[model samples]
Target: MSIQVAVNGYGTIGKRVADAVALQPDMELIGVGKTRPNHEAELAIENGYPLYAAIEDRIDLFDEAGLELAGTVEEMVEAADIVVDACPSGIGADNKSLYEAHDTPALYQGGEDADLVDVSFNARGNFDEATGADHVRVVSCNTTGLSRLLAPLQEEYGVEKARVTLVRRGGDPAQTGRGPINDILPNPVSLPSHHGPDVNTIFPDLAIDTLGLKVPATLMHTHSVNVTLESTPDADAVRELLDEQTRTFLIPEGAGIDGAGALKEFAMDRGRPRADIWENCIWSESVSVEGSDLYLFQAIHQESDVVPENVDAIRAVLGTADAAESIERTNGTMEIGF
Candidate 1:
């Protein structure tokens, strides 16, 4: 039997998650919940997804826009086996009771507080953490990327500490209201960014610090990472280890994929949906080690990397498959690798 999945929030992540869920043979995307009757709502309807009003009071707004509604979000949650809440930050917390009342499990995005869910999930780092849990939070894209790299290094080389500098895009392409459009701003303007603490939600004991800056570009977010390990491995050995990860895409220097623009172009040329690079794109030449420290530069497609993780989280919470099996099924079905 296919697991029935409903996505709440029809923004960037929610829309992508709905599409990814539809691709999974073991799951069915039953419906999507949207708070507004915007273009995304029209796209969902056009895609043949049943559209439910996330805010009951806003139903008339959708009607006013000439979009048909499936029902209220409560009705959708009642029918779904699981709900993926891609609502913006702070909103998911408000909708928790609706899912709880229906006894429907839910997976929330990283924007919500980690304490809002039972487990902070990263498919590779802690898939089992979400198994059978009623609620799970898929860590943010930045945290997801960091976890993907950290997990392997911690296992094979044993990390002593990690420091990361995140160069974040001001906003998603659709988010026109966001800024630093002309200038680079020190986001949070604080010592260590919240990202390091957010990572701790997945790896409680891991020592990591993060700094964040918002750049003018909306293309992609780039990360500069340095990890001090218990054992030093040469650059080639480090590359070999990261290359083994199914979700990590190593960008070879010889390929001339110099930056995010080329990487996005490469994804588009490969016919990737929305030019989405679901895998973490690490510069092959960036992998380096000195003594027991490892350093690398990687680009994260913030809008899309979490899409597959949400799919895997559904399977995890449902107990339908183990981590390896679920990840393999998701990767194969979604064509995740480069």
Candidate 2:
């Protein structure tokens, strides 16, 4: 059975999710819903996606802009087996009633409060947690990256404690409205930024603390991760374990990929659509183990890392496939590993 999927919000995350869903053999792209007749809306139509006006009042605006329409957001949601709410943070919460009214299952992004969803999902960490769930949040890019990394470690060696320092990008390349364009500022200046807590939504008992900062770069978010394991494994052993995971790309010394800029260039060099890097780019040279603790540096593509997780979450929520099969299918369809 091909699962019908509707993506509401045709922006950064939504656009990518729509394309990824279209790539899945077991899924059908029902359409996408947008608030206005922007370039993304035009792209949706050009790509042959049925474009639905997100707001009834905005239908005239789309007509005025000379863009074709597929009707209203309500029609799209009611027709789909599930809806992925890729709307801006907090906006998904406001639109929850629409999905609920249509009796459609919905997957929201990480910007939402934990209380808003039945479960917080990371395909590697807790794909089963989202199984049969009516509402699941795919988690933030940083949390998704952390979850993907820690899940393997915890499973292989048993994580005792984890600490991460996040150097986050201020905005995406197109997001000129965001600030700190010339400065690196402590984002919250508080102990344990929300990322650690967000991860707990997946691993309820894992001891992890996070610190965050905002940087001038927009290419990706970098993480300085320190994980204390119960068993002492050498750096090489850990590297082997990480490389075995499909969602992780360990940057080899020969790749000469020093940072997120080079990483994005490498994706473009490989002809990745939108230059999207869905895997966590872990610097192989940065992996080190001292005593029972492991340290590494990884860059998370904020715009794209969460894209595949959203696809896997679809099958998880619909109970269509197990984690391994779903991850492999999603990876194969999108070619996730480096």
Candidate 3:
């Protein structure tokens, strides 16, 4: 049976999810829900996806904008086999009762309170934890990057403890309300950033600490990470281990691979609009290991890295694909090497 999926809050994440589901043969995009009747609504309708209003009272927004409403959001929830809520952070949680009321499963994004869901997911790590779970929240972008990198290292080298300093963008590029606009916003400076605990949700047993500093850049988030391993492995061996992830790339020494900008250009030159999601560019030049400590600098395409993870979460929910299957399929379509 083809899985009927509906995307609620069809903005950045929702739009990507809708497109990804439409591409999967095992899934059918039955409908898409948007807060207002905007260009996304027209695009959804043009693509033949039935459009549902996000808010019941805002049904008039669609009508006023001349978009034909498919039905109420409640109706879409009842109709969908799975729902992806891409609404803002708090909204997804607030809407959870509706999904449960309809006996439908939902996949949530990073922003929601992680404890609200039965599982927190990053297809590579904690994927099995997501299986058979009713509600799953994808970890934050920085957390996703950290988990993906750490899991492999721990499996192969045994991690003792790890610390990460995150240089996060002030806001996503599409976002207007965010910025220090040419200023460096000191991290919580006093309190611990949420990432360390956020990672604990995925690895309940691992000892990890994270600090964050916000920057005015909207391109991507960069991390300076240090890991103390139980046993030390040479730099080359560590690089090889990380590359096994398929989504991770070790930028060559001579390549002018600077920051997120070059990484994006690399993906575009190869014809990928949202390449950063899958191609986590961990600088080969930045990789170094001494004694029992390992260090590296990596850049994550914040807006896009989670896109593929979202796709993977849908597959996990429907039991259509597993980690191995998804990794193989995505590797075939994406050029993840540097």
Number of the predicted model whose TM-score against the real structure is largest = 2
Which rank order by lDDT, best down to worst? 2, 1, 3
Give per-residue CA lDDT, model 3, range 1-338, as digits (tens).
87888889888778776877777766788898888877878988888889998788998878888899989889999999889899988999999999999999998989999888999998888777777778999887888888889889989999999988999988888788987777787788865689989888888888888888999888889999999999989999998898777778888889997888887788878877555455567998788998999999999887767766777787787677788887565455443454
* lDDT by residue for model 1 (206-240), tens: 99999999999887899999999999889999999
Assess the local accuracy of residue 313 in candidate 1 as a C-alpha lDDT between 0 and 100: 98
Flag regions of model 3 displaced more than 4 Å: 274-276, 330-338
All candidates: TM-score: 0.98, 0.99, 0.94
As for TM-score, the candidate ahead, 1 or 2, is 2
Report lDDT per candidate.
0.94, 0.95, 0.83
Candidate 2 residues 1-338, lDDT tens each? Answer: 79999999999999999999999999999999999999999999999999999989989999999999989999999999999999999999999888889899999999998899999999999998898888899999999999999999999999999999999999999999887877989988988799999999999999999999999999999999999999999999999999999999999978889999899999999999999999999999999999998999999999999999999999999999999999999999998887
What TM-score would you give candidate 2 relative to the actual structure?
Answer: 0.99
Deviation (Å) of 272 in candidate 2: 0.4
Clashing pairs in 3: 277-305
Output the number of the lDDT-best candidate: 2
Ten contiguous residues minimizing lDDT sum, candidate 3:
329-338
